[model samples]
Target: MSIQTKTVKAKTVAIVGGGCAGWSLAARVDQLSANTVTLYLKEETNPSHNWGFWQMPWLSDALSKKRAMWNSWQIITDEGIVTHHSRNHAYCSITSDDWFDWCQKRFHSAATTTEIIRLPVTNTDKNMLMTSNHKKRYDLIYDSRPPKADKNILLQHFKGLEIKTSIPVFNSKAAVLMDFRVSQENGIHFMYVLGYDQYTALVESTFFSTSPHREEVYDEAIRDYLSRIYNVTSFEIVKSEKGIIPMGDVRPKDQNPFLYSIGSNAGAIRPSSGYAFSFIQKQITQFLDRQTKPTNPHKKHDLMMDLIFLEVLKSHPEKAQRLFFKLARALNGDSFARFLSGEANIKDYFLVINSMPKWLFINQAVRVIIEKWKRIAKWA
Candidate 1:
């Protein structure tokens, strides 16, 4: 991080939508500079997820505390359980409410000029943030609102229930990262369990599909999963979170340099994998560190690979599970986690490329190249 010996506060910054990216930006600005930041929270919207990520190198931007963290995680497939424990790279999570509250507390404690209010943004123009009442301008406006999905999109949708069990029944030390024991009815379906303690955990049922499914579908799946996997008959739902994140290659709606797009709107989400917490931290961290701003987190190579992977999902939906299973089997836990977390090295990429069916990727790559050439020729 390039520390400015001469402290200069960036005054008047407006952050739309108090989501992960918005809060991260606001908190960083509050710490680094005296920037009078305005954080706009949409009406009747709570914070987003108990976002978990690797707690090293990128923890600076996560705003995680000792109180809100997990040490390890696991993956369960039809075959068996795959686990990884790294002291250097501990897995951690921060409840959305806790993080949001911390941000509020930070700005308040700092005695800086940070205004946070419930002003739902009606629309966003090129350079202006339109609210229900007033038109506000800032030196720089950071928008974290999600963009519209593509027509032919595969959404990674989920509904999770944070339950407190009546009896102590969880391994607080480890979290189930992915359990492929559930039926892949809509698409590749899995259940993720984040066990906070012996009696508390967030059990989530997630799917990747072309169309959206009802809450009942997820609710039923979660019930069945909890019953069969954990054998938990009694529990109280403390909190629930449901979201539909686009898995198709839909570019961010607003990519204008001056009018910054910071969260999912900024393409922090990977097209193939809908994991955004790590990338979100990376984006905000780079911006704050005076390093090259990560306006585009998805590299061209990653996008291309995702296109081929999504092709398999769209064209041959049945093969999606096998493809992912093979991928996991090929790479160790750390490598797979790193790849999913957007910290994969070239070797990791090569490992992924070599693991998948060569014919599928080669065919897709050739087809994409030909289509591109045809487009260029027509333009010429």
Candidate 2:
């Protein structure tokens, strides 16, 4: 466990894994690097994942042409369809291929000692990292590979289908957050996004289930949504993608010395919503801000939000579901739209959550209180 201090010298940062989190961190480190930075991707191939988020201007430079831009969004429910005009945010999307191109372009533009190595990293940090084929060393290591999680814990997974048609049944300007009409059973959330009617629509169903059985559930849900809601059976499958995001509180015990967890491995994914892109970006920004401090890279404020939200999620999974769905119902149209786009404020967030059946919110509140007491008692 070599814990090196940050001297004025150009320190080498070896970031393992070249996904959105790894690439984005590399780009930022390149910007901040008074020293050198290196990126390692396990796969020798270019990126092949579809990455998307409500387009925040902060990440505009990293967005690729596969990124689609939308101005409005919606949330569908059994009650009715509600739409909101996006005021502060635009729904932007980028495919994995496009995002890879964008990051490589940025890496190319940077003058720092930034290099992306396409090889697997050796598990040991003692000597020069000796891979089966190569050797390398770094002043610091950031590993973003999927951490082995406790399987007994449940994780929320989703499979999305990107469909296109000649006769668009979706509103070109609006993006749906969650279609509650898709049944609230087994902790599932459904959503649809229409990008300019003819371009394509991203429809997804999220299940608070395991990665193993998500495909069948998603396929069945998608087919049902298309037939009952869209009233269209003859649509071309433009593309399909699925993502597994951990929604549990369990994390790696701070037992590793030199290697620090990053991205989902670092507990950067939001527990309630499985949103990691923005969260990991935020963590990287903060890490850069305090990189000079004498502290463990993994032990930071990043855990605060994760812990808080995870408590809510684990203690009251049903309440978590109810809270979100109720917010979808309360905010309905445009409010729900702007909220997902990351434009809504704290007041807006609370107002929407507050609208759920008061008893459910009360139950959530009580659970939180009890959990906190247990923690305090244990510490005492």
Candidate 3:
């Protein structure tokens, strides 16, 4: 008797970092196959966070259960408020503690070997990860370390406070996506308020500039908005969260099939808008289809459009309030979400370009094209 046999190799994957990017990747991978996965986390303690990503098809049902969802969101401008409905795909948020717990539970339930180690892995040095406990070399290792931006990068920095008010205050049904009624002295300033309920919410003062505004600048503005706008004065600060995301020029994309670079380091975050959760979710879902070291021609049109948008904002920071509000008004509900997710087609984008301040955008667009072609000419 002749028998033909095949040996299946166990795929071992290692992910370094414990932020939303790493956690999501591990959870998705674990759900798909019985492959061994190791997680290296730097934070010994959970950094409480509220990660909000637009609902996507790849978003697992298990993870969806833990999020706080919003059906509608409003953007405040000098003219008035523009509200967008998320009927099909809602804007959702999940806490860091809950996400970490979910990942841990999944790993524990896995039939294959899986671990969430607290050891910090800096570089891709294989021998360095070898220890008394773990000595196996990973077939694939993903690095989620956030890269440091240049000094002139336009940052979306914010300081938020999640407070519990004495009485019902916030609009529990609709979230305040951006209130651009604040003073624009220190770059473009706005308040992002998300309400879990009428009594509880996260009120954040956000600034779009190179350096963050003073703590007092945000603190005072937040208090004023609460008192003046919502009539919310008596409230206890439950917790505070702070973050900095890039809203600058085009970033270099460095990714590969195996030993991939994931998260913000891989340019998952949209440069014009500081939204990476959706992009990260999309990238993690396609574990096998990642591009290695993306060049200018990969998504040339989309990248160029985003770069031009960012350039307009950087060159004329004062125009952000008008540009953002107008852009929101131009796009429909579905299109707005698509734009945020970086999946907007030419038609959707053209609608936005037409809504902007023509002179401001036109000048920036010309400069961006000239500079890009100049670089190409030199390289050629």
Clashes per prediction?
Answer: 0, 10, 0
TM-score of 1: 0.86
After TM-score superposition, the amount by which residue 73's alpha carbon in candidate 3 deviates from its true location, in angstroms, is 1.0
Off by over 4 Å in 1: 1-11, 30-35, 61-63, 66-71, 110-112, 124-126, 252-258, 291-294, 370-380
Q: After superposition, how far is residue 97 of candidate 2 from its true place, in Å?
A: 1.5
Candidate 3 per-residue lDDT, tens place, 1-380, comes to: 11111221236667778787787767655443437888887865535878776676766643455558887888998978899997866778878788767866766676767877776663444323443355546655666766657678789998899999998888878888899888788888899999999999999999888888778888898898899888887789999888888865533232333345677767777777787766777766554334232122114566677888878888878778888889899987777877776667788889987898788778988998898799999999
TM-score for each predicted model, relative to the true structure: 0.86, 0.80, 0.86
Which candidate has the top score in lDDT?
Answer: 1
Error of 1 at 234 (Å): 3.1
Per-residue CA lDDT of candidate 1, range 100-210, in tens?
677666756665687876888776665567777888666666778777677978888899999998888878888787888998776888888888888888899989887
lDDT per model vs. reference: 0.74, 0.62, 0.73
RMSD of 2: 4.3
Q: Distance (Å) between predicted and true CA of 337, model 2?
A: 7.3
Task: Give the clashing residue pairs of candidate 3, or none.
Answer: none
Off by over 4 Å in 3: 1-10, 31-35, 44-46, 126-136, 249-258, 288-300, 374-380
lDDT of 3: 0.73
Flag clash pairs in model 2.
10-35, 49-96, 67-93, 73-175, 74-175, 82-333, 83-333, 83-334, 84-333, 84-334
